[model samples]
Target: MRTVAGTGVAAVVFAGTLVTGSCQASEATGFGRLHPEADFLGSSVPVSERAGAVGRRTASVSAVAPDGLPGLDVSHYQKTVDWPGVAARGAKFAYMKATESTTYLDPTFATNYAGSANAGLVRGAYHFGLPDQASGAAQAEFFVANGGGWVNDGKTLPPVLDIEYNPYSTADWAGWCYNRTPAEVTAWLTDFVTTVDDRTGRWPVIYTTRGWWNHCTGGDVTVPAHSPLWISPVASDAGGPPGMPAGWSAYTFYQWAKSGTFPGDQDVFAGTAADLAAFAAGPAS
Candidate 1:
């Protein structure tokens, strides 16, 4: 048996290696609880209501509205999505949570992935990073093995790495950066992204918030140079995604709202339909 420090949970194994813990069980069986992508950035709350609570710059809705192809992202939290309805409502793309850490796979992923595709929405998968639980390479391998792999089929967007705040931060565990120093966080991110790139032949998109990026990675610029940026700024009734993090001059995708016209988190590609298609096709050789 293995226990996560401070989490008050122990992993129960049967075959001497099968790991089962509270978080993983919650994620796999759709019971109990685990964090979603927007939980840490405060996107779970509406922009209008979270003004003082967020205490960060909020972009005008006009500046950040669905100018480009609209999209949605979902996890098991948005259980039993209406993919056909989402497409009919004009969602051109989607990203679904596939795996988290090395032990948990989003129970809803396979169905969501197939449903979105059948509904004619270009789709991709994202992995929630748990840097403190295992090596980045291990998580990356696990993510790819489960559902985070990519193809150049012109309908599959590159896989995404959703690295953000430590949802497990509590009386037991370490704080936001997972108790790892800035350098350690950076190294872990490098390892994960590098491993994904090597396996998939395409760089994975990175989803993160400005504050988390700054605090966790020390505003590292190097990763942004290679990975496309998927930024989440708390959506306001009114401006753009928060300022670009470190090296990114522009964001490739913006998760503008937690709930809106779309079922899950509302998003928009930073380009036209053709550009989105090209993106799904992978970078030029």
Candidate 2:
């Protein structure tokens, strides 16, 4: 089996190209219709069962004492993770960026997943789902290929399909000029999720900003009953923004901020220590 220090991983370079087009200011914000075919991931064995084989379980341990939640997001740049140390410090779970396109792999993905597992943090991986790609299946295949395989029978958390607007693309385009319409982007995301489920026997989690969820999905996609939702809402020091969406009981995770230090790296994540444990548990059996 391949081995590396979990804390040794880091982020990698984005293609960093610019595409130009004006983005609709109103396009950002609502949960679209959950897709009907989104029910595939529910059939996997209970999360506990999967973790059983992996051994040395500690998904329920308190990683942190409620400074909020204990979670981390692993990107190409966050190549280093002191898994055992982080878990000891207050980290309970991790979301690793696995792949964005066919050619790219988050530089630290394999090492981080292995290291995080070694440290006993419930872990999952996410693919930066891109709409521009001609076929969603191609991107999913790339993720599965380059993303590391499971180290043991212990099931990592379900994979995530991250549908955020490419930061580098957004930066290069100046303001949101190179982005696509919300409808177009949503369709691409839906297609990618469907293709991945068909291939992996595991349905993916959808991670999106409030704006992206509102504009792209807009009550059109059908989410599986078991699929977890990871929402991002940056609020003021006073508290969260007004009007959290309705019909989102499926919301199991969230990204409350973009800055500050997390257990694995300097990135952010959504979920308290308990929530992270629930996340690590995978879907309920």
What is the per-residue lDDT of model 2 for residues 74-168, given as tens digits with 9 covering 90 to 100? Answer: 56454466778777866667777665554344556677778887888778777765455445776776666556222224447767876643432
Q: Each prediction's Cα lDDT score?
A: 0.73, 0.49
Report how far residue 233 has shifted in candidate 1, in Å.
0.8
* Model 2 weakest 10-residue run by lDDT: 36-45
Highest-scoring model, TM-score: 1
Q: Write the per-residue lDDT of candidate 1 for residues 1-285, one digit (tens) a residue.
A: 454344333333333443332242333432235444333223322243231233333333444465678998988777799999999999999998877776665656778888999999999999888788778998898888777888888778898988865666642223667898878999999999999999988788999876667767888988887999998764443454456778788889987766678877778899999999999997832
- Residue 43, candidate 2: Cα error in Å is 33
RMSD of 1: 6.9
Per-prediction TM-score to the true structure, in the order listed: 0.80, 0.63
Positional deviation of residue 161's Cα in model 1 after best superposition, in angstroms: 0.7
> Alpha carbon lDDT of residue 184, candidate 2?
61
